[model samples]
Target: MHKRAQVSVEYMAMVGLSLAAFFVIWLYVNSSNASIQQDLKVGFGKQVVTRLADAVNLVSVQGSPAKIFVEVNNPEGVVAASPSSNSSCSNVEIMLVMTAPDGKTTEVFSPVAANVSGDLSFLVGNPGLRRIQVEAVDFFGSPCVMLSG
Candidate 1:
């Protein structure tokens, strides 16, 4: 009877240890996946900002009216786009706001340096198609506008 009881206790201890190890691994994978998702969002935001800045610079240098199309996959839509003064260079700030499945609104700000003139226009909505247009009204002004499709 003593030997049987000892063997039962050992089995239970082994089972408990296995469960604990599995739980730890599961938690680690979940956290890692979350981190990776966040990183991807930030990277996409940066790319959008860079592309917009490049478009603006191209129009400004060429001194003519131009149009460029941009596709954005923002869940919360685009909230704002404006020129912001920086100490080192001129920057355009693009803000993207996203809503989570749980109804939480999150905003991501991306800034890029470019010689932008005039105003910018963009619409906010679910992840989908979009367009950007650069128009030069005169020698002194160049505006970049985001059009809805």
Candidate 2:
């Protein structure tokens, strides 16, 4: 009877150890996944912001009839907004408006998102404040830049 009790206790202890090991492994896996997700979010956000800033800065000082297009290029061809992976950005709109000193405003639609690479194009004509507004769900579908004359 004493031997049986000792063997049972040993078996229970072994089982407990195995469970603990599994719990530890699970914790590590969960933690790693969380870290990876955070990194991806940050990276995507930066890409969007950088592309916007770049496009804005590229044409801020230029006077023109300019047409610009922002492109999103990625190996997966999927540039999605936060929390969901949409193959393309559906909420993006870009408009170019030239406000004249005489209080005349001429607005034109700019290409918001295209799946391509290299310099983008925007059409704007005249010497004034040319406003370019780009709204998009993601920036990973193509290389983004503003090109104009």
Candidate 3:
């Protein structure tokens, strides 16, 4: 009887330890998934900002009014897009608001031009159909304006 009781206690202890280990693994996996999701959201924000900057630069260099479309995820909205004076050069700063899966909002800034000559008609809205219209203007001191389509 004493030997049988000892064996039963040992078995129960082993089962308890196994359950604890399983619980730890489950918690780790859940935390890892959450971390990966946050990283993906940050990466998406960076890609969108970089693409917007590239599009604006391309239009300015080509000296043509063009409509560029950008794809975005669950974006909160565009906060601001205007020409701002940096230390040495004037750049068009595009501020985009993005939301995470946890309902957290973040602002991403993309500088378009290092030296913007004229005004840029930057109109961006709707995450599904983001439209940006760049106006062709004279880079030199001469005044020039191009009509938008």
Candidate 4:
């Protein structure tokens, strides 16, 4: 009878250990998934920033009100027809935020149906050291890319 009891206790202990191991593995997997999601969010934001900066630089030529065009690209498969040239790249929404010398910021949204030209807000204060920031957000309202000059 003692031997039988010992065996029963051993079986219960083994089952408990198995359950503990399973829980640990589950917790690890959950943690990993959360980390990946956070990473994606950060990466998405960075990409949007970089692209915006590039677009601003491309359009902000010289020290004058030059008409500038923009192309937006969304790599997360969230936006259609990314890196679009001209107005042909439709349906995607974008926001252009420009900061002037007075530390004021202005925002413009798409349908930017026509090419725009103006003293970029960033250049208002300092012509040579003008700072320009453009941000394009996807349809989901997630930042696609932001460009700085």
lDDT of each model, Cα atoms only? Answer: 0.52, 0.40, 0.53, 0.42
Q: Give the per-residue lDDT digits (tens) of candidate 4, residues 64-104.
A: 33333444332221222122332232323434344323345
Give the best candidate by lDDT: 3
RMSD of each: 6.0, 16.6, 6.3, 14.9
| Residues 21-109 of candidate 1: C-alpha lDDT, one tens digit per residue | 99999999998887677667556655655666666556555554455555554433344445322222233554555444344555665
Model 2, C-alpha of 138: deviation from truth (Å): 27
Clashes (candidate 4)? 15
Q: Which model, 1 or 2, shows the larger lDDT?
A: 1
In terms of lDDT, the poorest run of 10 residues in model 3 is 140-149
List candidate 3 segments past 4 Å from native: 72-91, 99-105, 114-149
